[model samples]
Target: MPKGSGKVLAQNKKAGFDYFIEETIEAGLVLNGTEIKSIRQGKVQLKDSFILIRNGEAWISNMHINTYEQGNIFNHDPLRVRKLLLHKKQINQLRVDVKRDGYTIVPLKMYIKDGYAKLLIGLGKGKKNYDKRADLKKKEANREMARAVKAKNQF
Candidate 1:
């Protein structure tokens, strides 16, 4: 999901509907041992998560990575602010771009690639109320058109 080909652990479906995504970047997560294990087990949620660039560093906040069931005292926190690995230049660029009005960083999905946990983040502009309605209407029209085409082809 969200352009990732690997095993997708979690995804934020609302992110796409709420914002106009300008660009997406895949960044590494600084995860705990148990956290990665849980992620590999597909025990993660990105619905309420977001990305923020602060003090020249990127952080993913409110991302929930459930604890490994077999782990004991060394279990990682389910809701923790994890650091995102990005180049300094990319961070600077994000810092500059995020200052624009209506622009914010949102996490699209989380997946594992090459045995590492990767988070896909997007630079997005918040959509207006009217924009959301128009999008929904367009989607419905497209669906109707597809259905009509299918019926015609079947005749």
Candidate 2:
């Protein structure tokens, strides 16, 4: 109903911090009417959300799209395993990579795309402890450099 106003309901910032993302794919969600309404109300959580290829199909688990407060007995489960719309070839490739390479599928973000709720899923590998520390240090250094440049330019 809104023009050029695609709303991003939620995001999984921890996914990027913990995983080395390899590839990302946009997949549509299978949601009910009430679920979509709740998402539009911005009541969703992406923490601990993950993807898995099961029985030749992809499903998202641990995502909590809160039920509409006004909805009654027909309300969907908050943590239901929602189906992800992906191609058969993509599913096969994800299955192979996850099973053999010790990789994982993590939800990067959830956004309203073209008036439909979509998920940006990433193929990721767990980062080591040192890797996390190094990344933190790099970010701090970049921030310090930017601050110094700003201070110098202010004069």
Best by the TM-score measure: 1
CA RMSD of all predictions: 2.0, 3.2
lDDT of 2 at 41: 90
| Model 1 alpha-carbon drift over 4 Å, by segment | 1-3
C-alpha TM-scores of all predictions: 0.92, 0.91
C-alpha lDDT values of all predictions: 0.90, 0.88
Model 2's alpha-carbon lDDT is 0.88
lDDT of prediction 1: 0.90
Candidate 2 lDDT over 37-78, as tens digits, reads 999999999998888787899999999999999999899999
Error of 1 at 82 (Å): 0.4
Looking at model 2, the pairs that clash are none
Give the alpha carbon lDDT tens digit for every residue of 50-98 in model 1.
Answer: 8888887899889988899999999998998999999999898888888
